[model samples]
Target: MTSSSFLLIGFIVYNLAFLMFVIAILGRKWAQDNPIEHTRKWGNYAIGATIIGLAGHAGFFFTRWYEAGHIPTSNMYEFMTFLGMMIIVAFIVVYFIYRAPVLGVFAVPIGIIIIGYASVFPKDVQPLIPALQSYWLKIHVTTAAFGEAFFAVGFAAGLMYLLRCVNFDSKEKGDRKEQRGVEVTIFSLVMIIAFVISIFGFNASGYHARFANDVLYTGKDGVEQTIKQNVDYVLPPIFKPFEGEQVEMKPFLGMTEAPFEAPSWMKGSNAGRKLNTVVWSIAGGLILYGLLRLIARKPLGAAISPLLKGIDLEDIDEISYRAIAIGYPIFTLGALIFAMIWAAEAWGRFWGWDPKEVWALIVFLYYAAYLHLRFSKGWQGKRSAWLAVIGFMVVMFTLVGVNLVIAGLHSYSGA
Candidate 1:
């Protein structure tokens, strides 16, 4: 009934669709048999569920628009969710054209992971800051996100292309390549899982670590002073302040700056903790990755390959390139052109060398290089696929990493 309800329904429906696609992939071989009609049934249901979820996601968007009296692209949660929606949209478009249900195995999960990533951010709607109060908020941010969504799908396709196309026969170079690729993918999945754990931990603990005005802290000079901080859901200081201290006065762990008392430039006091948490998660993931390999005694990538034996890797590789080709100009227009316009209006400059802007340029330029290398240099198979993979990581850093680590002009407060 309410927008929140619609949003929940959308999340649940999309997750259900995600599972269906996974099922379709697992049962695809069975569905091809004349006697048993299962994969088709699951595939159709997945597609239908995906469409319904999109509608529900749209409902959430519209409801937020109505509630906020503006488009919902002004913050992390809204824009990130929109990005996830666009990935599914891109997948659907490709599906209609190619009829490749195999892509859905990777495509839907990519969207789900993105959506899951977005869910970890603060979800409450808040008034837009003065910088974001413009028509460009919708036009620029939505278009940029839509374009990057295609790129995200590009990453999925590229990964699929690599997994499906690589030669993995024992005692061969292909096997070695697949082993390395699988490690990277599995490591990525483990990082995601760790992030999910952090979110779950926060919710289960009802975590709210903040500092109101006049909060006491020892400055870098070791002098106790009253300060203001807006930290939320942050890990407590690794080394707490002495008894009777309201805030940790310790400023550094060796040369590294301590994860407290966010710098004045940061948009959120909690940014340090969020960034630290991510680093810890990745480090933990690496340990798990090593452990998994030790236990399994083989490369995870090669292990997963047999499940997708019938997949057409060439189709995936082509589609990966196509996704980038289709999305590049749009990304250029929205992320670069319109973004510059918005920056000029908001910050009195066309380009500020902001971290986010720099990363956006990096993503664009990397993909451009991928295109040139693919067409002009004829770097088609593994090399091009690897480029696509890297391009999406750059894009993701622009989207998520810039917010958490380098606050810049972008407001990640309560994000």
Candidate 2:
């Protein structure tokens, strides 16, 4: 099959499995009727399916890399795909220890949403600019993406805990409270899922719609001129269009004239930009369906559990702590130490106060505060949960915000 065909198939299979898992939770039935047995069976199936999906996703990614001849993460599309895969890998590791498949139901959809976002970008295998031609590109980007994936998982777990806590404490009591909690949880999940999907769909559709309008008005004669005009107006100096021949531009200030040619490698893969809109719409729809199932069940945590079997809240909490513990050091090394080294190598200085750099520092500080509040002040439960949520926000800022809003030295690469 074609690479795009393979990706489409993978997207369908993964999301379908995710939906089944959600149904299992909401129906209060797993592979069997009993909670432990049900959880064990369903959890295994979910993780197993995720593992298979990850393999397929990785295959798609490597295929793109081979075609592109460089890393696959030179733009937002590739970056989001890579991040989604990383989140699945992290989920698998956490699942084994926590044995909570419920987390996967929440986490996987978010990964899917990110991949949907990636689909918004043209799937062309564009070439690396001169600035992105260094070894640090691989190290810096891979580490940053890994950190973002971990942060995303952390966010999922926090949300799940919050939902579960609300159900447990609701004053209504009994079946009524349980029913109400389930409704509320499902509503929240659906709303969040819809919003994310909409963003991805809107962004992809908007770009293509605008491009189509431009083409209609400009016609074939103005195609080249239109490309040049759009490149001049829309692209930042760092991301100026590539023509075939070399044109002199200040690398530090960004591109002036477009490059003479797009790298030879990018030629056939530029699939019409509108294709992304179709792909995102389908992926986003599946994600929304899975979330709707989660919503319909209401009181997700309580419905699935008569008693909080095998999994302890404290244990789940500790698992999160451990994940943060392991991730924190690696994140620090990559975001702070390695990023600075790369900046110095690229820009002739270690720090430039770029938006990306500032956000990276902000993420670092946020996590540091998380650790401090947890250990020094002896905070836990809701307090720590709130901190974890905030830390993930910082990570998101470093990931999407840095790439999209605050253009900087690292902005040219993947989010």
Q: Please list all clashing residue pairs in model 1, or write none if there are none.
A: none
- Report how far residue 92 has shifted in candidate 1, in Å: 0.8
lDDT of 1 by residue, 131-216 (tens): 88889988898888888888877888888777776666667876776657656766787687667666666567654443333356
Per-residue C-alpha lDDT of model 2 across residues 1-415, encoded as one tens digit per residue: 5555556666766797687567546545433447566656666777777777887888887788788888887787787788888877777777777777777777788778677656745677889988777888778778877776777777677655554454454457564554564444444445435545565544444421111112223565665433322221111122222332223333323435433323333222121211222233345555775664577564445554443333356655665666676677777777788878987887788888987788888888888888888889988775665566557766755666555444356655543
Instruction: Judge candidate 2 at residue 249 and give its lDDT.
Output: 32
Reference-based lDDT, each prediction = 0.74, 0.62
The CA root-mean-square deviation of candidate 1, after full C-alpha superposition on the true structure, stands at 5.6
Model 2 earns a TM-score of 0.70
Candidate 2: which stretches are off by over 4 Å?
Answer: 27-33, 167-228, 231-311, 413-415
Clashes of each: 0, 11
For model 1 the local lDDT of residue 86 reads: 89
